[model samples]
Target: MDAGGVDLDARRNTNAGTRLISMASGTFNASIQRVKAWSFADAAKTSPTYDWYPMYGMAVSYSGSNVTSASGKSISSPIAASFVQNYRTQNFKRVLFEYIPDVKVMIDSLSDNHDALNSHVIHGVSNPGAWITFTGDSAIPPGTIKGQAEGDTKKYHIRADEKTGEFTFVLPEGNYLTAGNKIWIYAFLNGKETLTSTIVEDKTPPDKPILNAITDKDASFVGSAEANSSVTIYRVSDHSVLGTTKADAKGNFTLVLAASQKPLVPYLEYVAVAKDMAGNESVQSDAKTVQDTTPPSADAITQFIQVGSSFDLKAKMLVTNVRDNAGNDDDNLSYTLLKKPDIEVVGKSEAVVEIADKAGNKVSVSVPVFVKDQNSSVSKEAMLQAEDFMVKARELPKDETEWDAFILKQAKARAWGVPAGNDISDNIIVTNRGVFSEKAGTYTITLRVKDVEKTIQAVVIPGTLSIKKIPSDIQFGMQKIRSFEQRIKPQEETKVTVEDGRSEKTRWQLTAMLEAPFKINEEEKLPDSLVLASKNMDGNIRYTPINTQGTTPVFQKETASEGLTEIDLNPAGNTGLMLDLMPGNIRSGKVYQTKIVWTLENTP
Candidate 1:
């Protein structure tokens, strides 16, 4: 135990003996050393021994040291340890790494790389483009993450900018990552251990929700969409959001429409949209209409009519409408008369008219009709005395231009008994509906009179057919033309006017022909753009009546003496001979005029 002096026995055991040993090995000042130290006890040996050194050093070839690989795959091999230098040569740190394993991850960078996923917009509606950004401690060179799922592979790694580490990532339009997906980040930098992050994404909109049905009663709507997603109901008529609700896990949703919304009109359409947890909203679904709630229209009925000479008269009842909205199903409606009308009597009869539709909605009304037997005939003596009708002979006044058909009741009533209108009067039925003048002249026709009961009749003196009251002439007023645009209807009178012809029976036709195009000047002649057409009451245009010579029948059969009634020059049609000027023929500063001819003739 003496210093520096050992006997063979002590030397072997203490110096080079197998009892103690020391060894060392390393690279980059990184190494591992093992040693055994021994000391001789003074005499009695206690648990006391020289301070002992347990195994230590840069952690022997740190390998197989791993955590979950960013990819989530169970990966394990070896962790490469490297020495990173700092400002001071002697100051350094060990970075557990594997060649800074390349990963094709888009590092959307701002300041530093971090998973602030909670701050990201769910499915960005306003800013729909999708990608990610972050800041990293060091520049991440471009590289790829090998051996990844088909679509999970990132082929290009994000490279950090020099200082800002600011960069943008733009995904292909249709390739945006969807909601509920996650991005696995595995990054490495000098002097730092591997960095990682898991960002669940919500960048895609949910599928459209279905608008299955809408009811008018409860103002309710129902449909299905993405499970667990929220649904928003909208009134498509105005695109106003009607209500919102959460879909059950099964994707079914019901919406009791908001009471604050305006009352639903008939056939109001409703649509639904879905939103996922990621704030992604789906497009609107198909539309459906609300129920029909309006009731049918009807009015009370009351009437008094003379009974027939033999039996009771059946007067028609009054009804406005009998079915659902717009009465679309009116034809499907059924009616039930609660009570029958009187068959033979002069008394009030009440009948309830019940109207029912396919939707089971019903309405009813009561009609009370009174019947009386007061319709009497002329006395026998009055009918028997009837003879040749006596009428005042009439002569043309002066310069007669038209004639009208007429029947004279000039007979001084032989007995004149029945009701005032039933007394013998002008029997010439033709009144104002017929035109009788082919040419203006003094004309006369015999009059015929008949008793109300038609049991007696007579003939009277001839009567004159002469023009009477006449209407104003046609005048197309002034007009202003701006851009040569739409066609213009001439401001002419609503109807044409001419002299009326008085006659009992006459048949004639009026034809007209328009002159050629209006000549404004030698170099500016307006094309014959005027179209003379007639319209039915419904406003539908009729074919051009002009013949090859521009002559078209303007008046017809109503003027025939066979059924001539009264004097109406233009009675054939009220909305007749309408004229329109086409746009192409319009000039910015020129006016136009043309001559027209009218000819009357007997029906061919």
Candidate 2:
């Protein structure tokens, strides 16, 4: 019946035979066997027991043995069953041992075995109070075992004295010895060593370090280090090692660049890498570049002529200033004078001027000199004399011709009159004496001497009659006229005769009056006695009306006695007259009047 390696499958198949045996024996042992088989299968599926089936099967087969089962089988499954059942009985006894007389005696005998569990008696049975006792190693002791019981398993905690290494426990009142029924104890030496009496189980992991921030050397630029606690800066272009730094207490670190580490060219790029305390690293930050470039400022220079003379060709100019960003005046500025045709050179007879300020700086200005003559004259005395004479002559006469003639005559007179011993006399003189007649006539001469000398001479002359008449107070009328019928006629011609008198040429002009309220008949005819009249040698009469064809008669037979002529009147019964005497120098008060009349047609 040693069923330590018994097969559960064979036991399940034998259920039918066991039922038949049970029926012959009038017992339900077959049902019990079926239930036990089912429990074994369930327990095996839930938490497999290493030797449970073999031990349980052996115990059931040997249950009817007389010598408390065979020693080998008893020691195997039956011993195990007996242990469970006795453990329950012992627990019961321990609970009521003091009250029950038999239990009291039974437990009293087992009291000594508590310290060292041994074989003992119980109520009418031999070797009844069998139990096992446990003591921990030198560092721990046995203790009251407080535990929770489930279907086939139990959880327990052993309470023990820390210093005495002792324990107290109450056994569970159960027929089955569970896997957890064994006494266990725990002890810790300086919280490091593992005690043989203890078992520990844990299923947890350690915590990881968290990164906060990353900063530069001066703490100027910072970035996130959420997963890293350290930083390193590197040259990305060549993967050159720059530097490394550790994170601070707050999981923050700084990265610094060395002063000697400058950009290779105009720009440089750097990358930041971070590693966490847990050895987790992050990708480098995006490359950042800095640029350095500067341009030069504008350069300018100006030059001018020192003296105000012409600047011809390249030799005449001088540089005034040289400038640049470096402000180095010692540096010579290059320049060339351009020959511009439009600019003139001053103080030069033939050439043109050219000047310039050229600094390779490209900014330049040029100026040219102009040449001019500086000779002129002014005669103030001559101009003043001529002007004064002209102004005086203009004021002398209203007529331009008269003023000119008078000026000429005055100049001639002044030329003729030379100095004559301070006495002024005419250049020509003439005198008249009695004339001599020719016909054997006698002549006489008388001469006398006194303070004024006198000389007289007489001679016989021929007889002559001289009638000279001088008209007095002769005046001319000023009138403007327009005529329709008969054009105006010149007035009567007054004649003067001279005979053997002191003869000298004397000229006279007669002035006539214009008679008004006169009219002329259209059909009137000239008398046969009327003749054509003439005045000056030219015979151009000023009294003749303009736009007329025939001459107007001076007198008709009927008006001859009255010395009058007919004149025509306009349709409005009005007539106009004008008389222009020639050779304007006339006597002052010579008066002449004539009455003239005419008949009007009075036609519509």
- List CA RMSD, all candidates: 34.2, 37.7
Candidate 1, lDDT over the whole model = 0.42
What's the residue-level lDDT of 286 in candidate 1? 87
User: lDDT per residue, candidate 2, 1-604, as tens digits?
Assistant: 2111222232333343232111111211111011122222343253322221112122212222111221111223444454334322111111111111111101111111222322111111111221212332222233343321112122223423344333334443221112112223222211111222212111111122222232122322344454336676666789886777765665555555456543222234666676654454556767765332221122222122222334454523423333333233334234444443222321212222222222233333433222222211112111000011112211244554453344323222111111111111122111222232233243332211111112223323333223343233222233333232233333333233333211121221122222321113323222211112334367553333311233343322221111122222111211223232323222334333333322111111
Report the poorest 10 consecutive residues by lDDT, candidate 1. 83-92
TM-scores, all candidates, are 0.32, 0.20
Candidate 2: 10-residue stretch with minimal lDDT: 380-389
Instruction: Show model 1 residue runs off by greater than 4 Å.
Output: 1-106, 109-184, 189-192, 215-218, 258-264, 291-299, 309-344, 350-366, 372-604
Give lDDT tens digits, candidate 1, residues 157-202. 4333434433344332322233334444443222111244444455
* Residue 343, candidate 2: C-alpha displacement in angstroms: 19
